[model samples]
Target: MAKTFASTGDTAEKTITFAEIGEGLYAFTAEGDPNTGVIVGDDSVMVIDAQATPVMARKVIERVRTVTDKPIRYVVLSHYHAVRVLGASAYGADEILASEATRSLIVERGKEDWESELGRFPRLFQAAESVPGLTWPTMTFPTRMTVWLGKRRVDLIHLGRGHTAGDTVAWVPDSRVMFSGDLVEYHSACYCGDAHFADWPKTLDTLAAYNPRALVPGRGDALDSPKMVADGIALTRDFLTTLYDSVSESAARGLTLKQAFDRSREVMDPKFSKFAIYEHCQPFNVARAYDEARGLDHPRIWTAERDREMWEALQG
Candidate 1:
């Protein structure tokens, strides 16, 4: 292969930052790694987007202990991705929650995704053996569900699909804070291996309608103000549109997937090359864009074998 496969070369540990974006709401971010959200209520706590491994999740739990003694009663999944859901067991929460669509995706591709991501990002899965099989949600809702942590109201809503087919956001109406899984990234590359390019922007629109005062994105630093939130959303939209448009144009011209990848680089590199995981995400992003442009409604499952095959075909 011409380049390292995915993030296998990235082995250095990142500085973990647990920032309070709202009143009693925290965002556990590790540079450009996947982020986790904490919502502390009058009674119990709710955690959003568990990390990739049980050991990694303990890092979040450690931070959660510093603030309040409230037990983490619920763990909410933003999507069905292995990197986001496999750490659920570490929380030991009373209930694990997810959108119905997310649960369905897990049932269909959970095992494959776990294997594929472990191969792609070895550093994220610090203790692979510790992941006790696929993480399943004990509770699920179709579109929206509300949970109360004492007086705090958390609305888990499926705005639409962007990062994946089953993306959900946890909204705190009292504080106007939202925990957006991978739907809105800040100065970080959006991983679109299972993305719906055409449907992503509309989902962003629905998320924007809420006008969150503070937002904890799926990756990068947390947005602590409305301006930052707006910028984050716009940046994500721009990234998606630029990628899809370039790939769609290439497809329209009957270009091969490799050719389309080169075309996409020419357009995206100048604008987003400096972003976190930009290179790691580009091949998969372009492949999905190409598939979507050519009328594939659902994303193809990515197994460990398929991951290497696609990487070699494109990145080689």
Candidate 2:
């Protein structure tokens, strides 16, 4: 469908970089691919988001070993997306954590999402068979939960909905560093396939109030300074607002889905065409924005079958 969903051709290997943004805090970024945040405490370590497969996660583990030999006690699922959580088993952490909404999403659509994402982006899942099965969170929380690794404290908060209903961020009060899931993206297209477009900005505001000295985004380079952190948040906000405004206006003018897509593309391409996953995400983002602008508060679940249906309808 739509030629492997737009990004299957992107098989070029990305250069991986692991930067220590704060004391014992690292951001493992592979160009524009999904990023993994590492928080090492005095005695133990914590990982923010797992990669797509256990094989892929080993790369992060290899990097982790380079710095500290502390045992990884926790793996935090930023959200319920298969691309982010499926590699959890590789960590062998004592506990896996996620929001209650995330857990419910896993129960509801985890398998379908696994097939859907694996098909859409083959490059991310290096070894598909290596994924044992759907990753499940052993521990779940509602709004906010705090965990301590010796003296270091990590606060996991479900700020609000943005990338998905279960969006959660890890806040390290001591370092003022935030591990924002897909709630924010920097110089990359926000995959709005399951996004709450209207509610995203408000959540961004809540994130900004923290005034994080550094931010580890779900994708793109990690922001090491306060100004870069603010810039990242601003860029994410602009992308969402522009996408919704373009599609909402077209919808108001009685445009069909295709017509709305065309209008949205004309407005977004010039500014965001170079962003990571812009091509892969535009159609889905426009479709969701169109739906949300029409008063749909909750995003519709996306399955492998539905993904093909939407892609063929818009891209065919």
Candidate 3:
């Protein structure tokens, strides 16, 4: 039998957890769903990645209210993923910030991504109609920007491209806690549909240089220790390397995409198959890796139609 298309079959709801990694920084995470980071500065709060929809984002808001009633002042888009940015409206944040590259992507393919992702993972978009439209960043920075809530300083840095052409990480200088958006996933599979495979590891290296005391990853449980932080980064690096190495080797040998996919499974399954969204991500991951290995520097835009076509071609 053919496998389910993307995460459409993943209808079960996951329990949410809100854990404090730093003094005022929190991680709002579901079982292995997309995670959101919260930074409570002295005056207001800044959210890392919004949930999939307004309804989904409210869950994060509810958790935020439990600890502090300070208004959510800023909403940060880690990259241009529908599941991460569509919930911006719910925050009612004064500013929606993203990298310039991310804003360009939104202008380029945000509408198509919204449609494609809604089809791929229906569960995440709890109230699809609630989305106002393609989320637009109210503010954008080319490389790095800083915001201060009272005296607490939060630096938003576009370290390098990894998960997407534009990926930004929020760093709390005071607590040494880093909110690494999809750049580093804990136990969950890194969705490489728009990933920069070769650049990803170098970005990871830049992130490691900070030696964050505690880190909140894009998914899975929050890493509250330096050891766990290192481990998470290492695990992400290993996953990317193993997949790219196997798929690239196949591409180098002139294997077909299907042949490359099968070969990748044989190599990646033993270690990463058990990860959340591992199956959901493999086809796209294999396709992108194959392309990059064969010299595609930029990722192709994924549309609802292309999503189905790719799934049918690979999963069938």
Candidate 4:
């Protein structure tokens, strides 16, 4: 292969920032890395999207400690990605919540995803051995679940499929603030390896209807205004659509997977080359896009072996 598989060479640590976006809502962002959301209610706190590992989650805990001593009573898993859900134990919350589909995905592919992601992006899994095992949600809901942190209310809703089949958002209706887990990204490449390219845009529409005043994205800096929120949603939509459109066009011409990958990159690189994870995501994104364009609706599970085979086929 001409290059390493996925983000193997991306070892530089990002600068973490904790910014207050609402009354007591904060976005814990690390440059373009996955972000964590904090909502402080009257007497307790709720965390959204735990980091890749317990050691990594400790950093977010440190920041949360600076602002409030209220126990983190809830930990919400936005989806079933290992990098996002494996750190639930760090919170030691009363209960961990996730969508029913998310929980099922964990049962089906969680272990495989753990191995695949760790091999691809080692930097994100700091102290990976500290992870006791696959994180499980003690509580599961179907479409929407509401939790009251004293007077404050948080609604965890599954708008539709996007980044994954079980994508869910933490919505604060009263404050018009949302924690969109990988459903929206600002100036960062959308990782579509496990994504539904066709369903993602429609789901974004569901999120936009809320007219969010502030949003904590899965990656990049927080969106603190309605305009920024809209832009983030638009950017994510554009990335997914652009990628799918390009691959669809190539596939329609009966291009092979490698040929389709090259053609799609030519079209996408000019616009997205500089985005975070652009290089790491390109090969997998195109491979999945190629499958979807050819009428494969469900994305294939990606194990470590499949990851290597796909990388070599496209990047070699």
* Candidate 3 lDDT: 0.95
TM-score-wise, the better of 2 and 4 is 4
Error of 4 at 249 (Å): 1.4
- Evaluate candidate 2 by giving its C-alpha RMSD to the native, one decimal: 1.2
Give the alpha carbon lDDT tens digit for every residue of 259-311 in model 3. 99999999999999999999999999999999999999989999999988988
lDDT of 2 by residue, 1-316 (tens): 3456758889999999999999999999988899999999989999999999999999999999999999999999999998898899999999999999999989988988898898888999999899999998889999999999999999999999889999999999999999998888999999998899878999999999999999999999999999999999999999999999999999899899999998998999999999999999988888888998788887787777887788888888
Residue-by-residue lDDT tens digits, candidate 4, 1-316: 2897799899898999999999999999998999999999998999999999999999999999999999998999999999998988999999899999899999899999999999999999999999999999999999999999999999999999999999999999878999999999999999999888889999999999999999999999999999999999999988999899999999999999999999988999999999989999999999999999999998899999999999998898
Model 4 worst lDDT window (10 residues): 1-10
lDDT of 1 by residue, 12-101 (tens): 999999999888999999999999999999999999999999999999999999999999999999999999999999988999999999
- Choose 1 or 2, whichever is better by lDDT: 1
Candidate 4: which stretches are off by over 4 Å? none
Q: How far is candidate 3 from the true structure (C-alpha RMSD, Å)?
A: 0.6
Q: State every prediction's TM-score relative to the real structure.
A: 0.99, 0.98, 0.99, 0.99
Misplaced by over 4 Å in model 2 are 1-4
